[model samples]
Target: MPAAFPSSDPAIPTAPLTAEMRDALRAIVGEKGLIEDEHGKRPFVTDWRGLLVGGAGAVVRPGSTEEVAKVVRLCHQHGIAIVPQGGNTGLMGGATPWPAHTGIVLSLGRMNRVLDVDPVGYTMTVEAGCVLQTLQETASRHDRFLPLSLGAQGSCMIGGNLSTNAGGVQVLRYGNARNLVLGLEVVLPSGEVWDGLRALKKDNTGYDLKHLFMGAEGTLGIITKAVLKLWPAPKDVCTAWLAIRDPRAALEILSEAHSASEDNVGSCELMSRAAVDMVLRHIPGTQDPLKADTPWYLLLEWSSARARQDGAEGMSEKMEQFLADQLEAGRVLDAVIAQTGNQSRNMWRIRESVAEASRAEGPGMSFDISVAISSIPEFIARGLEAALDILPTIRPYPLGHIGDGNLHFSFMGPSGMDQQTLAQYKGAITRAVNDLVTSLGGSISAEHGIGIDKLDELSHYRSKTELDIMRTIKRALDPQNIMNPGKVLRL
Candidate 1:
């Protein structure tokens, strides 16, 4: 069920929108672009995670970058807030409309397009609405690779990825969306377009403004399009699922595998036995990666260019041999190395289905956090201890892109624990976990971002000086606080 909001809230703008305002907005975008029906805006009104359900004055599906710019310009002119959205696959509730409904949702889903693909330059210029998988396929057509592979790649937009600076499985090697982006085309709060779409390797001309909006969560401006950097397609690929005793052993095994395969290690994800069990139990056709139920598992990948591979020099054999050594050394419990592409994909299916499988369990509080690679084990130990102490019956589902020191810490409720009760204790639990994370020199938010869901927590974790500067920038760019207002930072 969708979460409910308080009827009497200060943030919600209760003042009605005048007929003159609607006419002015409709004139900027076409009549067809304007969506007035409450039912018509229902789908776009709520967030993907179902954490935040809101109402908007109207939904405007912009067809082009210019149309988006015009809509933003009009919102700015009237001091109305604007929430730019893409596929709405965000977990942070960043794209959800405000209850104030004082704003309009700028949906760029209609602007989906691959404007240009330069195989020679190893870059692609795409609209914000282009699906991640589409971008990957388009890159593959030219014998290149767009390595930002997230679970939501099938439905999420490149715009949302860029906005979140998304880090997926490949972050262990390819880095996040911020690294993949070479240039960006954004629409400022003032309704002006800043086209910094130069796909250059090194251009230190002035301030690198792109980085500011990359993870700003749309608080500053709206990202309309972007030029993403790609890489040469890897020829030889290897995937393996190894059973480790714990996160410490998983990290140790990852270290050994990297030594044997060099930096060819593309992805090294850590998964708990419980996490894998959830997938096998809930996800259809999903089976255990290994025969025995170990305490933890590691999904390892090694990719190399075609020219780099030689006969009898496959990395899988080396990876398997290393795992064998670790098993003998008591570092690992058991392991299964994929012999074919299909088998490798099957193993990945277990890792990727974690989120969905978790949902089948029950309503819970989810956390995306990160710490130094070496500090992860301690963080987990302390975090789990803290969480269990607070919610004894809470099932701890700890998993994530461990290679990046990030973990998706979730607490599954036992039978009969209503979501409302869980939600009521959410702040206390998050504070407990975040306090531990902060003490370990870690971040409260790893990859998900500080959308509306964690805005208060962000303010809690961030220093006053840092938040002051962020507010200064938001006010400087969006004086009226109309562009994605009440999101990342609120004045």
Candidate 2:
């Protein structure tokens, strides 16, 4: 059996859910919506990584926005804490409820629905629980594209995407979830529903209220629905794998590609030798794209929505010429360009499989960080050196969207290091890397919000004034702190 929730405060009496409160919630969501059994609640209480296992008073699923609001109102009346959950694919422990705290898991999965799609307006109105991939496919059917692609897109819901302000490989061109949203429908801590789902591109009316809940991580409110921006689907896409001398060379190629391709570069990714090796080792049916092994590799893509003129070259031709120029300039030692759709998918699979492959190899401390594009090479060189200085046997496996300067800088413990030994180095390595990133004017938490994992780090790195402002907003919006308590801000 899973351990009971260990409380920090022993003096305060634990509040069990009363029959009246349960009846009220059940009335709002119906009998099928409320999950009270331990077996039924296990998936919602446990995080994806299995690192965080918590307990929830009950798991409630409300199908509609009205139902969700009513459930929140009932929880508010009863003074019961709420933990809004989405797909439960978050890297940070943002969606999981605290074991020490008593709350109901307010899951948005039942709210999954595509309300409207405006191809001409370039907008898509969707429920927060809509899966990212489903939205992407829906957009594709209308000859449009929702460029928010990620590894967990298959399961991660849009609500969690909005709450976390997630960033994916296409962030280099399309921006993060915060940029794609035009409006939001949120359930405030007071059980008040704030409906701001406008598809308009320009609305210069007062402060944009939607921004408040975009990356608030469920601390401010529960995101139930949203108005998302869409783009014309690309007609032509070119994917290429290049073996570069180092990170600096990859950056150089990125600069040249933009100029040569007339800024059609859709994605630019950097992968280390170790990261590639990890993928080939753990992932089946995957072969190295290039014969010669280099210290680093770059996965570059160029895409165009417009069709090619009758006698003109297309994106593929342009990418080929760009790669030729780089090879001649010694920036790219070797390269391979995908000639078919299957080939392109295969190439992307290698890049997307990095996380899974790394996990299969061993436990490691991972960081999602970003610095100025110009300082990426410096940050990688100095940060890796600093980490190696601390523990010489450490394996640095850093990879990410280089165009935006966000790197999933992760380090695998030395071979045969037990879990206990690995835990000892996590803190020191994280601090050393974070210090280097901060000194170079970078953010410690780039795409991933500060869940429980980085709460203390945020307190340490963020300025007192900045922290005070965050707290002030939290207090004004969620004075009761009943919404996802102990997340984003410490009480």
Candidate 3:
């Protein structure tokens, strides 16, 4: 983690939005698409947590790719910076403009539309602003599935999801957001549209250009539309809550689950008892599935496209048998398979609500990092030792998408300590934890992209060659450095 930026302006394109330029923007998009009022532009400039307040002269919502290109073209001509935003639900300040930004916030909200759905091809073409949950439901309506899910699915847009290359619980099965996309239509910094919206699965024509923009945080270009991959809908699914012996047991159980469930392990999430309790305490309508005398728990789900018929041994039966075997092996101390839809929903609700619960609990630090699957238990052990040594009273609630080796390493500040006080120790605590991660060949910022939060950390952790290549790409694609200036890379 890195310290927050100072109030003073850093080097960004300060070209003020002139009256003529505003008129040009208004002409490109209708009045409803343009938000020049301070109150109207507030949400676009502010980060999701409301902790980072940025400044923007206006917020421009384009209804079409054409409109988006026109707005970018106008900005490019005048040397004005543009921060491309989608859903504005990003944890990183990638979509939020800098406090000194005197240009526009290009919002994709008005452009949301599902353009096409090819059931035969198993693909869907959609505008960038379409909400993730909306796309999931759309896929369901077509009897297909979109597996890129997240806690913020209801509000996070697909463009933002791709921009951050987001990873959620299902990444183990469906891969990250980038993996779910077939192609993209991006508006480059020079106002040129890159129409790479092919629905083909195998296009090795040249450099994988779509990938560059997918995780670039809109620093390289503005993603306006995309062609997304779809999978067959899961008809037989089983959800379970298990109290495991320890972190190491989690790995073993998951390792065996693939064959036991016939290779349909959709998700394997590790939850600390503290994390579960925190969720149960804050989130209403969520209940504990089981209470066992163990500090570690696992939320395992197995799903398959094959529907279960009468007299068939469904997912639950398979899972029940698997749990029995694990319990006999001394791996799972206790476990319960979800018997009803409501029961399954409750189990998932607890896992998804951890972020909300943490916010309600107050001042806390969370690091989203990933390591080799086998290295997870060791990383957890050494990482906790290092963090606790720096701040002994720090409350630990270590949890994650354990199957994918990504941990939401989190902690509550010591009792009675305010956020300001906790900030003083953040540097040391961050270093110890990240050092352990780096030593194990793990990522410091997993799932979450390097926005303002980890801008300096990326610079510090990445090799000079890696950073140099990134800076070179950023410069070549956006020479003016006006595309989301002062984000990701410091150049």
Which is the leading candidate under lDDT? 3
Mind giving the per-residue lDDT tens digits that candidate 3 earns over 1-491? 22356433447899999999999999999899899988888888888776688889899999999999999999999999999998888877888888789999999988889999998899999999999999999999999999997788889999999999999999999899899999999999999999999999999898989999988999999999999999999999999999999999999999999999999999999999999999999999999899786899999999999999999999989999999999999999999989899999999999988888987887888899999999999999998999889889999999999999999999989888888788888889998988889999999988989888788788889999999999999999999999999888888
Q: Of models 2 and 3, which has the larger lDDT? A: 3
Ranking by TM-score: 3, 2, 1
Better of 1 and 3 by TM-score: 3
Tens-digit lDDT track of model 2 for 1-491: 22222223222112557888889889989999999999999999887766678778899999999998898888777678888999999977889887765769999998889999999999999998999999999999999999999888989999999999999999989899999999889999888999898887899999999999988999999999999999999988889999998999988999988888788899999998898889999999777887666789999999999888777899878988888888889999999999888788878888988877876887677899999999999999998998998989989899999999999998888999865677777778889999998999999999988877787788889999999999899889877677888777775
Candidate 1, residues 90-179, lDDT tens digits: the string is 888788876766668888888898999999999999999999999999999999999999888888999988888899999988888899
Give Cα distance to truth, residue 224, candidate 2, Å.
0.5
- Model 1 residue 439 lDDT score: 92
After best superposition, candidate 2 residue 105: deviation in angstroms? 1.0
TM-score of each: 0.96, 0.96, 0.98
> Candidate 1: where are CA atoms >4 Å away?
4-16, 307-310
Highest TM-score scorer: 3
